[model samples]
Target: MMQLEQFYCRNYRIGPSESDFRSMYRPSAMLEHMQLAADGDLNAMGISTSEMLEQGLGWMLLATDLSILHPARLDEEVSLFTWSKGSKGVLWLRDFILTNHEGDRIAEARTSWALIDLQKRKPLRPSAMPVEVKAYPEHSLGDIPEKIILPEGRQTRETDRFTARYSSTDSNGHMNNARYADLCCDNLTPVELAAGIRRLQISYYREVHMFEQVIIERTDAADGIIWFRGMAADERGTVFEAKLQLNGAA
Candidate 1:
């Protein structure tokens, strides 16, 4: 049986600023909270990120599948619960739930990650991890597909191009993972942004370093469903791809 102590929990308050004048928490912000809870969980266990870095190991996110049940309002206190869902082959999985102060679930996510060797920049198998985490078997989003596939023969449009700024880079010296949602969403029609995001799935293919340029494109596949791909301006291939599902017709 899974014990309560095995999961990690943290609380946070929504800020005054919000997404698209809707006073709703943005996907990017939710992602930031997710990262915080994951790090805090490991940190409390005496395996902090810096410590892992010193050992030439670090966590890298490959994909995330999230669902926003209800929009988190501004200035509200919320609790985030996370757990290490264990590792399989080269992928380590984790799951999370965001709840209001009332204990009602508002959001949940499933993610796939890799523990990469800092020096070699390659993913290590679960058994090869220097540190061990007791993983539980609960899956909040059920099974996440091993891959995120964009629509075949999908139409694409070049929407915008920009360089990764200093503020956008994280400790890995690459564009912060959370920032990709904003990069893709920024290309959406204002109506779509205002409609609010109900679900989002993203896959990271490569890293974008500080000051490196990226080209973003958009393709709408179905009603309330939009896909985006960010490619390296220098032709390093796709940096990331995302699919956003809006709440309703907008």
Candidate 2:
């Protein structure tokens, strides 16, 4: 059997469907692409999430840090590379680098994942995988997203509310991780949206099932970073939290 390459690359062109109202590629769509690339690479390496599910295991996103350096053009195909960066304790690491035709960087990301026993809802070590995934730590995309703690006493207001409808839920019977990027952007006020997304940092806390109403709460720091915390009307805990850095918010 031919051994698969540790690094994987895929090319994608932005189109009307991938771009938002701003005519720029949507972050949510970009994340979904990343997911597809990751899964494809994993399948080549001898394991796929679908295969894991049969064993009562699944992958869950813990945190992700995506930074956009330059937005890709709608007419141009961009090259994206992804590789596993090994694991840390129970958390598996993955990184991505996206570049345009000229080899100029478009975006990069560092993501953390955890394997879980689907039936028991318990985290498992990467060693439990039926096929071990190789790591290419040399391709790390920088630091993984850190846990975000919303400031105490900072004012946070409800920005938007919506039901986790059928269209948003995946086979897991809950919202997919990538969809939250659009949700976060949709809740942004015009001022915040106009600032433009330069970096997106997210920490997934829990799942939002179909029919559950999610109330998006937002706050901004003096430095221009907009923070969001999604809470479900029926759940006591936060569904997710995210930090958005605008083009010049640094």
Candidate 3:
């Protein structure tokens, strides 16, 4: 087991803007914080984004499984630790742990990433990168699924349709991975949003570019889990899919 001390960690203070109506940190904001910590870990390992992009290559997220034990609130300070769990073929795995100022666990996540050729938009073999992989300790949240499967035959409906805008893009020039969480939540009813998300798992199938319209579909709630799927409106295929497990209002 990799120990916490072996990971690269960063501290963050929850600002008012990062919280929701209940003052709890928003799911999107938490995802962003995890991303920042991952970036920090990559930088520490001499695997900066600029360095990769210089080679006409970049990292793309394939999936993420996040479990929120206790969402942080405004004015609360938390520490986020992230480390690589090594690579397997073209895919690399990483894990994150977020702890409160009192050292209590708050959240944990496991993420899978793949290297891609920026020009061709094709995945590259892990060997294409010069960086070395090191296994780290896994968080207490347990192992995450390599893929999230949506239950079939559930009552489904078209929730919303919208076009991706420049503002929704990230440095990679595609829809930001964190924004997917926001989009998923947007499909939820007010009551569902108020229930809040206790756990979230997302799988990215294809990238969505600016000006591309997307159709959002969601399955009726089943045992507190709501499943969502986003597809390109033009028949470009599936963009991403997600499952959210809800918790009662805070």
lDDT per model vs. reference: 0.84, 0.83, 0.84
Candidate 1 residue-wise lDDT at 222: 78
The residue-by-residue lDDT of candidate 2 on 13-63, one tens digit each, is 888888867788789888988888888888988988688778898888889
The digit string of per-residue lDDT tens for model 1 on 39-103 reads 99888766888888888888889999988999998888999989887777898889998889988
The clash number for model 2 is 0
* TM-score per model over all chains: 0.93, 0.93, 0.93
List ranges where model 2 is wrong by over 4 Å.
Answer: 1-6
Flag regions of model 1 displaced more than 4 Å: 1-6, 17-20
Q: What CA RMSD would you report for each candidate?
A: 2.1, 3.2, 2.2
Assess the local accuracy of residue 115 in candidate 1 as a C-alpha lDDT between 0 and 100. 91
State residue 245's C-alpha deviation in candidate 2, in Å. 0.6
